[model samples]
Target: MRNTETIPAELSTLAACQEELVSITQCAEAGISKHAVLRLVRAGAWVRITRGVYDTNPVPVRDRICADYHDHVRRRAAWIGLLAYPDGAATGGCALALLGVGGLPSELAPEVSRPTWMDAGVRPGTVLRRYGTFPVVQRHGRDVAELVHALAQGLLTLPRDHAVAAICDALREDRICLADLGRIRSLIRGRRGVVAVRAWLELVPGRDASPSETFTRLSLIDHGVPPDGQQIVFRLGGTFLGRVDFAWILPDGRYVVLEVDGREFHSGNGMLADDATRQNGLVGTDRVIVLRFPAPRDSADGDIGGQVAERLHPLGWVPGGSIGPVVHLD
Candidate 1:
């Protein structure tokens, strides 16, 4: 290990802002030679992230194997792009992730963007987009597109459900209000995927608790069997039964409670017991029919939609009555 006393203040401060990462130019400016930097890498005190950038606190093996490994790597990749292209700002999903916006896809590439003239040829680990004069703000110690711009750019590439989920996450997290959606749409007005992105943006009511809930809700809506309510609390004589993921109001005044079971929050003994208790309490009301389905992994998982349609059909839900034909949000 290198001596803390020998650590240069310039390198320390620079690394502190860039996720403990610093470039070779920064090291040189701090009076460290290339030879000493190589020795630090060889001695396992630092890790070379790209050609010139190095991570002072190398990620541990335990963290590499943990559940959050992907998220950790995504953040590092964002920093890598920012450090590699100092003038480029993190954009699209990378910017959204850095801004603490949730509901992004599990896999996302590090993206950096600058003006069209500054085209840097073919970086391997990061995707570069060419743009001109978009808004920028400092986020996570790196420059990124402003929230509205980032949302528009992200929606252009994400799948319909994912785009809707991202908007839901942004609204729920208070990153943007319903009013800002108009500005986001304004930005995407003449873009390639504007039609679909506009429709997807309308799906974000922002009440769903997780990405799984967002997926399930979209699936049901796509099949023309949208839930009447979501996160609806059931109670009998003021004793709280539970807040359900989605709910349907039958014509006869009975309720259909649909629970989207996601592995993240549904696993383990404690959660299982809590789920059992909640279901029992809801059933005791005698006005609720509970349906549990594993959260849909993709658009093709239509079992939840089909089953909800089948159950509702017997209880006075006409296929084309107030709800129109399947919207088919692909």
Candidate 2:
């Protein structure tokens, strides 16, 4: 009874809508009868995600188990909030999702803010806030809070590791830079979590390419073994030795390379072989010791900080020197 592959001709108008979400009013306008919508819903062809909203995507069940599916769910929630309050703009995690920023928690609550409201009704899973004035920008054709504003909003609420990971994601994606850090601070000024967010900001070098790398770096810092640099490129004579996720220069001028392997970026046979070759090249350089930390299934998988510390201590890396800089992109 499921018809995910084809859209009925009677629902052409709904299919033409910009997003998967379509209102009942819009369906009526498109010449689709209420009976037809009801029948489709009964047939599992259309899903009702909200009171009067339908998700026309009809995605397969198997496809709903991956990270991409989770991201789609986040976007769907944002759309629901946006559709419910047309004048409201997506902010916080909703804006981050729409902007394609990663390193977000698995659970995302849709948030929207508007200057005013009429008959305030209940939005099932969305959070509504009132704001006098704020900067708004369009992302994915929907109104969203500006990048730094959204980051500030998200930072105020996300967990410590998640906040830092989001900042790292923003920097890695070139969505923000060290210069924007001040603006982000200004937005969160006088807020409850400003102190913690500021401390985390100082800890971020904005050079780690993945959330796993950020987490790995944070673990090291917590154990008083922060790396001197991140995303450091090395060269042996005229050949490139490849870039390391993190590196520390010992007193004797040797280097400790920390590589964080996240499944998202490092998968399949090709990536594995490339990683092996890169590791071989780095070791052949004869002045570096490489440490690889793979993605963990649970919090108890391994001690990233302890492992790195074990390698670093033997090389005369003291308890602390200085962490990497949050480089200005400009």
Candidate 3:
């Protein structure tokens, strides 16, 4: 038999307690018996996520194939932090997604940090991490990994491109600050993932708004003509003019703007007009040169940012620094 409609009256008193998730031990502490848990399961009020972990918000049986269902299951990993590993918390790529910065296109198996002895034994969808310092505190009412901790953890798990993307994405989204990156740099001084992440972050611009944007920025740097600024905003005295994706200031003081069409953000009629208005104001009064780069179809098409940099060469923008080249997929 399975849970059907509502929570049983005996267990109803613990409503507030089960908001995040619950465990058998937690239920016992709340004066709820195993029988009550089983009844709630039968009433369709809770869904068992792992061996002892139960999600209070059950995904309906018929809707399991939907996208939202997948997102729901991934979020259940947070409960492990709140219940099983009270001191530990979500980390790695999982925490990155929670913070709204990890630029992964698809869902990944949720990862958490816990002591070796915790022994969640055979939880299929969950990955238990035993390395690096954890025990992150809550950020938005949910137990979340600290930015540096999350970045370090993420850098270890993700490919270099994706790791850089996540860092830029988080910074651009305001999910993390540059000062915090410095703090992470110090905190993870001797950690395993520190060296690689640190080296990469040195060249990454926080002005990138998304993973693709991060890739674009890296492409420019790798091609040897990095822009002076990204997400550049223009203001005339007191009034706000507009902002562009990338900007370079020529030796003669003329400003050049480059906008990459990543296909991630598309404007409707209203937003399109607003953007046109802003761009027009800048172009008409400031005489700024604006260039747009549409995304490359595949790796063979070469880097869009590199292509943009070559165009800027004739306009008096010069490349800076002789860093090693980025691993361009193209």
Candidate 4:
């Protein structure tokens, strides 16, 4: 009599999950009985991840496992969800960044999305959702949702500022076009956790070159002073001045240039020298006021809007004004 206990995990088909993990039921469906699973564990070929989930390796070790154990658990939980709903896919930031769909690095919790309802409650470090109207497909051997679906989910889950940065990151990468963002706004309309995302979309001005630019622009608008031109080029009598990230045409016919300095682009001597040269070009007797705000890595922690407001307040920028005096560079 052939013993199922002697069966190996490698040869089991139904037990095969995307990340070398599977549930006992999946093994059973693949002709691998509970005894076979036990045999694999005894042989150190599989390890019990959770109550039902099992890893192919008895002692699976990866670089990520040490750095962040939550990340490891997150991936395992996602596989468990996938075991039941094979059609569903990993959603939110984790999947979006991993799949290159346009999101910040998935530093937050692990989140997955199913087209239909899911049976599991929220697992530790995992946020599951039954959301968005997107076809789930297998990408890179793992289920993934449409870019828009993932993007919207990101906006819904991440903190308000983080969500704005995530959408802006996707926008910078061209992973989702401007029109598609509008489409996402419509698709996620009336959905839970859609209000903040919707409000941000309405506030974000077009033509932002980077996440910092978007964040800074949104801050100004939120502060009640909308910027006039984004990524606007300035020329002083055929001499090309740098294009500012956020700009305002002041009431006195001078321009206020807000140069958002993100560490990646504005750090180091080369960039500093270049920035100084550009600022010099934009300054002088002309009423061109330049305000340099070193943008924060995370918008949530940054008080750039308040700083801008404080700098501009002395120059007569109120909550509802078309233009104000040149914002002080100091």
Best by lDDT: 1
The whole-model lDDT of each prediction reads 0.75, 0.74, 0.63, 0.64
Worst 10 residues of 2 by lDDT: 321-330
Q: Candidate 1: what lDDT?
A: 0.75
Error of 2 at 280 (Å): 1.6
TM-score ranking, high to low: 2, 1, 4, 3
Task: List residue ranges in candidate 4 displaced over 4 A.
Answer: 1-87, 101-106, 115-123, 195-197, 318-330
lDDT of predicted model 3 = 0.63
| Model 2 pairs in collision | none
Q: How close is candidate 4 to the true structure, as a TM-score?
A: 0.68
List RMSD in Å for every model shown.
5.7, 4.9, 7.5, 6.9
Q: What overall lDDT, based on C-alpha atoms, would model 2 receive against the true structure?
A: 0.74
Tens digit per residue, CA lDDT, model 4, 190-260: 88867656887664436667766766766776676667666777766566777778776645566767898
Better of 2 and 3 by TM-score: 2
Q: Give the lDDT of residue 107 in candidate 2.
A: 64
